[model samples]
Target: MAQTLQEILLAPNRRPKVVEDVTKLVDSEVSDKSGVSGLAVKSGYALIKKINSSFVSDAVDSMLDNFVGRMEPYYASYKASGTGSFTEHLTANSSDVADALLGVTDDRAAGSRRDSVKKVYAKLRPQAKKHVEEALPRLGALVEEHAAAVNTG
Candidate 1:
């Protein structure tokens, strides 16, 4: 029988590892300059690429904050069930993880912060979707590995 996404998500022992690996992979792939540049070019804002890159990076960080925040309760519930390492790791490195996920490097333009905020509103969803899609395959594989281990052991 195939496990559902919810089943995978709620699996106490496996979920943390799966989430950690998936998030890392997504962060690495989405934050790649080549990938962001491609997206900026597609947006027809290639000339303002630096600004757009900062906006995308900030947007992704915000998105990860929301995502990780939502997962906090789950983390708490599983805290004694072997998720302590992940919980501690997340607590210690969330900012770094967010930065990695966002791919932020240079500071946003001081004067254009307001404009970048406005642009990020328009770009957040699509960029989040792209990152999620990029991470899906690896996430699936992790889940499968967990399921296989559970079944055999």
Candidate 2:
């Protein structure tokens, strides 16, 4: 049977490598995009790498937790006030949201950041999800192989 992600992640020895591989995969997927949205993806990749390198435990989970927590309120407020999809809401308020999230000061920089966020929400979100899902089986296999090698040697 194929091991679930949580099953692999729960193994103390395997968790860090799994997290590293997943984060790297996500970063790669985001970085692989083209056009103006690539700017946001690159920024996001940098932030993810920074978060991942900052701790000994599961940094990706921590980042996700924080991101979700922060976003929930924004999403709720948007939902309460608007009728469109979240992407549409985000695109309409990208500059304000980007400024709030990133603390960008320069108007030009904020505009760029807003564009990046809009691109991510509007276009790249599904691709990012699919990329991660597609990578999981390969990552699990690598983990199994590593475990076997470690056990044998």
Candidate 3:
């Protein structure tokens, strides 16, 4: 049987490292942003971090399971296809992949008690898809790296 992303990534031995890598991926994505919207993203991210020092890591940890769940179908498809990198598969299905990931955040934001956090999320949500789409390649690479690690280790 093929290993699920949840099984590989959410395993107790691997979850922390996956979370840390995801946090770094997010940080890099945010940092690499440019232009007016980029500034907003960077600033909003900074504000959120200031609001809670561990917010990024905490969010990643909390959302990882859902994120992996959302990606499971796509991952399964990639495995079945047996051609092209996961990066390419994610890029080819960028809209669906990005939307699936964002859905997790949207749900989280909707249930958030902190008005400030909600406000920040609201302001950033408009441009989020483009940013997320741009990050898909890196996100794909990150997933592939972890999956490969498990295969080899």
Candidate 4:
């Protein structure tokens, strides 16, 4: 059987790199935004960062496993289909994928002790689905790259 996405991504040696890559992905996604909603995302992200220098990385590290778990079903479907790019598969199912990803953050935000973080999340939540959908291509590519690394290594 093929290794699960969680197993592949959360391996002890690979976890840190995965977290780093995820953090970069978040940075890229946030930085790529524009317009009013984009402004909101950027500002909310900036607020989170201002609260803690390592917040993004720490959040990525903490959320990586949940993120991978949320994505596993889509990954499995993509691998099983053996057709189209993972990016295409992800984009094709953008709503579910975005929801699944957001679910992780929603739960985290609910339990967060930092009211500032929760407030930022709430502010960003309204537009988050669109932003996350936009990110699916790069996110898929990142997952595919990691899957390839495991296959080749």
Model 2: CA > 4 A from native:
1-3, 47-58, 63-153
Tell how far residue 65 is off in model 2, in angstroms.
10
- For each candidate in turn, the TM-score is 0.38, 0.37, 0.97, 0.96
lDDT of 1 by residue, 53-135 (tens): 55444443434334444444434444445643443444444444444433321132222456654464345534544444444
Off by over 4 Å in 4: none
lDDT of 4 by residue, 1-153 (tens): 336798779989889999899899999999999998889999999989999989999999998889989999998898899899889999999999999999999999999999999899998898889999999999989888887898888
TM-score, model 2 to reference: 0.37
Report lDDT per candidate.
Answer: 0.46, 0.47, 0.94, 0.91
Q: Which stretches of candidate 3 lie over 4 Å from their true place?
A: none
Rate residue 51 of model 2 by lDDT.
48
- RMSD for all candidates, in order, please: 12.3, 13.3, 1.0, 1.1
Tens-digit per-residue lDDT, 44-107, candidate 2: 6565445445432343544433333434454566548757554555555554554343321132
Clashes of 2: 0
Candidate number of the best lDDT: 3
**Candidate 4: pairs in clash:** none
Q: Write the per-residue lDDT of candidate 3 for residues 1-153, one digit (tens) a residue.
A: 227788778989999999999999999999999999999999999999999989999999999999999999998899899999999999999999989999999999999999999999999999999999999999899988988989888
List clash counts for every candidate, in order: 0, 0, 0, 0
What's the lDDT for residue 153 in model 1?
61
Error of 4 at 145 (Å): 0.8
Query: Best by TM-score, which number?
Result: 3
